[model samples]
Target: MGPAPTVHAESVDFVMLYIVAISVVLLIGITVTMIYFVFKYNRKKGHEPVDIHGNVLLEVVWIVIPTLLVLSMFYFGYTSFRELRDKPDNPFIVKVTARMWQFTFEYANGKKTDTLYVPLNAPVDLEMKSVDVNHCLYIPAFRIKEDIIYGQTNHLYFNAKQTGDYDIACAEYCGLNHSAMYTKVKVLLDNDFTKWYGGNWQPVKNGSASN
Candidate 1:
């Protein structure tokens, strides 16, 4: 309804809105056309059913237009996915471990917490995995989700442009207590985050500030 909450969220929103808009336009157009034809060709008016040959132009137009629309949607979606896979040179990495009904966020400094704490406007990369069964980490505000499977790792990253708390839920339906599998992302200011994260982590040689 409003602007994107994170840097990559806008890209996802763009692709989503494009598909939705196209679907709505086509839906209305087809519905209107179908109704008009139904009433115009009513049998009650004694309209003769003519065996007419199909028009090549009309058939080609329908086929080509739908094909182009599908290709365009795939293009937008693929580009957005590519952007998500590109990691920064000096990203702040967080290990996200999911189990039966809980999530744990481990920072570089070995500090673990249930609630994710990230600095505002800073890029955060998540390395996610599950201990037992499969799970999925979903953050609607950030428009990011990744599967957490045992013996495999998944990744998702986002830059929090806004400062506040956002809900994080498990989209995958696990065993009992799945409804309670939720957490919050607390976007803190730099000073506050530094205090929570302790001192400086491993230094970076990229001429930029380190987490």
Candidate 2:
């Protein structure tokens, strides 16, 4: 009922809502219809089954309705996907290198960190590449997940609206320590991020590396 933490989260939420709503409606409708049919046509009632051989109108209605529904779902899904795929025009870029079990983020100022740091209410673009095998960068709070392929460049953009730490995980299993491929994204206010990025502000430790 409320907006998600990130800007792109709203769009993802909308798509998910649409899908869940449609699924619930269909489930209820089918359940109710089955119950009613069972009771109405019970053998105890001495009722005879009526044949509905080829009702053209019914056939057309079912076919057309489902076709339209599938098309609509596909359209909305594709639209939301495109919104994530297209990179921001001028986003704060960070280079991410993913290896067997660790993530190395290189900021514009040449500062590297094991964890991610971003500014609130600002668009940040992550350019990711895998050093050896396949990996995935997943931010659950932001609803952004993209694969990091070896020798191929992949990227995704997100705008953090809240100032807090969010979990980041490698969605793909790369090696033996794939589960250890975890980190946190620290979001700070505009001024604090500026200070930290400029190497002036010291961030409080939250069990992960900040520098």
Candidate 3:
């Protein structure tokens, strides 16, 4: 048997690192400030709390700093999302249909199925919509997730750089079987994918087939 695909695992790791770093810095800063204030103004330590409340300059500084920080975060997040969703010059277009407890993927050649398959190192544009209730097309490995709203189409794009099996789950609560609404994405090397699609080769259960 061939080896399972690696999917977009690296992207997930990068995103996780970014989140962790941001969280750690914020936590440490808050913790240090809290501890410093507690020790500096302790009653038993021959210190008294200064009750100089409502300093305009301090209030303005706190408000402006937090506002700027939040806006910066928002800008970065929006740019990241824009880059992820924008269609590349020539992407492999795929149609995705989300249902109550399953997802159906359709290739450009009119083939349709539950599983998602794509060529590695290629950009893929997912034109997705919901068939029944609202659902989300979530590929954690790619750091991409978009809602598949009923009666409306949503799109997402990603370049799969690795070959592996990746999980696809609904990020929104659609129905009873929301937990079971999942699928797998298989990223195949370019040449191997061509051979597989052309009937010249088949993917083995546990082997690496390079492009």
Candidate 4:
């Protein structure tokens, strides 16, 4: 088994922290407002609930605040996505094929295998396609995931900074054995990867074997 997923970049970590901060701020604001309104307008405080139909200022405040919040979120999310999707100048390319219950990775030298082998600190571009049904290539550690349609190819790029093993799961339900369809990703040092790629490496018989 591989180690647990880890966020490998400062930028990704910052984006996650920003999202959490926004959520906390929104939650606290809503909670405080709810409590204040409830206690201030309670019946036991000699206060009768006045049905002041609606205030134009209050309506505008609510609408404008939410609109601004949503737009801000959209802008940040779009920029982050674009940054992640942008291709590097010379990224390592790998072809990933998904079938009924297994994943096969093919490197640039035409070596096919079950496990994904990548060099640490090197950006990898994965071209994914499904042979039988729809599947999703998900690598939580890298915060990258994309769907692999039967007739279409999907792509994603990421650089792995840590040299270790990670899990590759099929996010989409393809068949009865979809739950069992999974693989491993091995991130190696640059020297070790060069040695492996330079030497003749045979493909494993099935996706269950280790790299």
Q: How accurate locally, in lDDT, is each candidate?
A: 0.87, 0.85, 0.75, 0.79
Q: Sort by TM-score, best first: what order?
A: 1, 2, 4, 3
Q: Write the per-residue lDDT of candidate 2 for residues 97-185, one digit (tens) a residue.
A: 99999999999789999999988776788999998999999999889899999999999788788888899999998979999899999
Candidate 2 clash pair list: none
Q: Encode model 4's per-residue lDDT on 1-211: one tens digit a residue.
A: 2432333445556667777898899899999999998888877898766788889999999899879877877777677777676666556789999999999999878889999998776668899998889999988776778899999989978777688888889999898999888898999876798798985333222332324
- Better candidate number, 1 or 4, judged by lDDT: 1
Clashing pairs in model 4?
A: none
lDDT of 3 by residue, 85-158 (tens): 55555567789998889999887667787889887877788999887999999987776789999999998788
- TM-scores, all candidates, are 0.93, 0.87, 0.78, 0.83
Best candidate (score: TM-score) = 1
Worst 10 residues of 2 by lDDT: 201-210
Question: How well is each residue in 1-211 modelled by candidate 1, as lDDT tens digits?
Answer: 4677886889888899999999999999999999998999988988889998899999999999999999999999999988777767777889999999999999988999999998877778899999998899999999889889889999878878888889999989889998999999998877788888897743332437543
23 Cα displacement, candidate 2 (Å): 1.5
lDDT of 4 at 26: 88
Which stretch of 10 consecutive residues in model 1 shows the poorest summed lDDT? 202-211
In model 3, where do residues sit more than 4 Å from their true spots? 1-23, 46-49, 199-211
User: Order of candidates by lDDT, top first?
Assistant: 1, 2, 4, 3
